[model samples]
Target: MDNSAQAPLQTAEDPLFIGGVGLKSRLFLGTGKLGREELIPEIVAAAGVQVITVALRRVDLSDKSGNVLSHIPVHVQLLPNTSGARTAEEAVRIARLARACGTGNWIKIEVINDSVNLLPDGYGTAKATEILAKEGFVVLPYINPDLYVARDLVNAGAAAVMPLGAPIGSNRGLRTKEMIRILIEEIDLPIIVDAGLGVPSHACEAMEMGAAACLINTAIATASDPVHMAEAFGLAVAAGRAALLAGPGRSLVAGASASSPETGKLTAFLEANAASG
Candidate 1:
């Protein structure tokens, strides 16, 4: 029953906060390309996801059994995305329709005009985000890992900036890692790495690099065992987050560093023994 709209902005225990809601889980699961609609609840529970993204086109209000909304628990925050919209105008229209369906105000702006690459149009996304944000919707726009576009979204009143790790559903695993790192460093808002994550390691890498969150779909849904995959992703996300919080040691550029002391009594004893032999 706890939705983003009603949830508090911050809590003592919860660290990941988006759209005025504190989420314990950093992974956001997508409903599209799922193998079975019936596995939705189990997938969600297995992943321990607090937010699930559903395409507006996939929701059927009339067919109760087929409706994606029916399978989702009321407690989870619904992130209705404009997946099929090819233009800003079309995206805006879909967002309004999604709201009318009582799915909540969280909208993921996906304006992809490039049919070949399926990359989002940055200009159109910014326009739609500005329009929707003013309308009191929590706008999370998906874009190629571009610094300027991310800045534009921030100025346009976006809740968080979602930069794709690679092409949508490619499962390529952080091809744009450097650019995404720049966004995470410079952007004041939460930089959620979305799209093209292939495995649990990909999600883990994103979290390790200080990404506020990650949204994955194809990798989990198309796996041999979806429930187990979801669980793996959940554990991976948590482990990466904990590692980040624990402050991993700096990586050396050339020379290797030993875990134990290099110039200690043990090293001296070993050297003496070797010399005597």
Candidate 2:
């Protein structure tokens, strides 16, 4: 079932499930990058993403007007991410804030200690996932594609697991596809391709490779036309999935198909003589 690179696809009627929510479109969007707040609703309506990912940070409890949560539409399920946390404690604190802020009950847990480049600290991410899951939050830990780490997260009661393609903002395709494939095979949770996917093909490839969904931001928001990119990516994810279902030709050491001559076709040879116009 290898669908690495295949033809384009259009959106279908089926929906993918994320933590019991049926997403109308498998194309997941990130809310951190784009700024044309007016176009967000239109773009989301256009893109058809049921699960939208957002960052969770301090809300400055004093400033009653500091409500970042007001920007998103009510219909979409907000999956808050611990994008700026340096450790498990910080992530847990942010998760609490997110749970307080949003109406939903899920957190996309990520513990990135470094500022230069946000890389998930495996230890911190694992710890945060474990703690948050125990605390009654649907912890969706964004971590490396380590099968054992994923098993540990599942044991910790995580709702789902996210693995990166490269680093955030790198725009690189799946540099860890083999490891991710291992995770896909070994784990039972939904695998969302979280970061460094530059194009729709990347997301579609993730779906074709057996990932449940993908989280895309830099690619869509940074594009020249974000709305169109979103639509394109939506189609791409669907297309890749169709290919996965359609299946592909097997590769093996065997004789290929060989063409042969026609069996018998002399009956029509004299028909031209009878046609006297």
Candidate 3:
């Protein structure tokens, strides 16, 4: 009657509950940089992503071609982001439009004012989260890894807090590792590390640091081979999560610790040999 043996195993379908919805996959892929829109579904399938993101904007009558929506499979949940919005009201408007288009109620509030860095405006994001959450939309706000902003977003009803490891699309790997670590420790909600993850190793590092999930775009989209790259990231995320669950060892500040028994010391062996000789 071992309880451990009887316990249910954590499978791939193990749900990550966010905004009251259970998501199967921790990797949330963004539909932005695939060479062709037709490649999206295939990439997502290769990545095994259960949640995907999309942007909202006015329909382009000039192109008169297939839209990005048609490429996305119906099984995945859509997380519409307010990427172009500069204010809370603008973000809310976009969210409303996205919902109206039947894209579901999940929204990623990305209110950016810094054009140079493409950094999210924490205040504007929190403001939008408050409004959208009140309107029954599950809000996931992207912000700098600032503890105060994270706290504010949590208070504003954010389903999860998305903190940047580096500037968006920089391909930098966890530049704000310390700050993100603090957020992971202090924030009650899921800490989804979005932006600045250049490689699979970077995503793995975030997961190893106990990040609940990661939102990667350029790293996968701009790779030499995006399809295979997506697959690598998927494996990296899972490996990192497993490493986190395995509980990493503590770091040594300066000194080295012996891994094996000191009793079988080489010095002792030498002394014995000399005495025998």
Candidate 4:
């Protein structure tokens, strides 16, 4: 094996590095087809995601009063992603272009070979990561949470792996939990749960299970109350992870639900409250 191939695996102690930028928050947000740009900042603030995903080719320089970029605050770093490209070559070209446009070193490599399903070809993902990492770009590969694929990505110099919970717009919760679990269990690198997270709980579950963070967009943007939902999700992710760190309740063998009140039940508590009123 080449000496370069002997690069050690990543560890949790080390933060996710995207070129020169280092993100503190694990939750990632994407700027996709969702609308109401006014609500975007509010939602981003509510969710407390340190890294925000932006597409390279989709950038409409024609409208450049810095309209889109201006809306985003300076504090939250931008993660330029290759969302529209079909092949690794196209994705690489777009990534480089986006890096130049945004002047950001951190790039999320998204090589979606399957346009219809929008699946990340493991081969394409690996290729992109290798090429980008070689170019000294802080590359984060958005891939399916396959254990082998994820390991390969990390080995290929990926700063992080972003595995989808479900399809991009499906709003499904952890459809690939088992795969995510495998990645979390094995890789020392940041395993970001990206896409298909519908609610805050989904994010929390991923984090609690040892995911470095999660990415969300459609679910938050489409909520009846987008801003409030973002806040709620932030709290939920924190709460779930807190529970994990604090240690969850242990299970015991039982014939029935052990959660039943020993002293009083819900009916009794309601009756007491009613009497007091």
174-200 in candidate 1: lDDT tens per residue? 999999999999999998999999999
How high is each candidate's TM-score? 0.85, 0.82, 0.87, 0.80
* 90-122: candidate 3 lDDT, tens digit per residue: 999999999999868999999987799898999
- All models: lDDT? 0.87, 0.78, 0.85, 0.76
lDDT of 2 by residue, 1-277 (tens): 1123221232435556656665656677886667665566766766766667877655577875634456667776788888778889999998998888647778988888778878788788888888887888887898888888898888888888899988898989898899899888899888888888899889889989988778888998888888789888888877777787788678753543333243234555566657773
**Model 3 misplacement above 4 A:** 1-10, 253-277
**Model 4 steric clash pairs:** none
List the pairs of residues colliding in candidate 2. none
Better of 2 and 4 by TM-score: 2
Q: Write the per-residue lDDT of candidate 4 for residues 12-98, one digit (tens) a residue.
A: 333445555554456677767656666667766666656777775454667754355766766667788888877889889988897
- Order of candidates by lDDT, top first? 1, 3, 2, 4
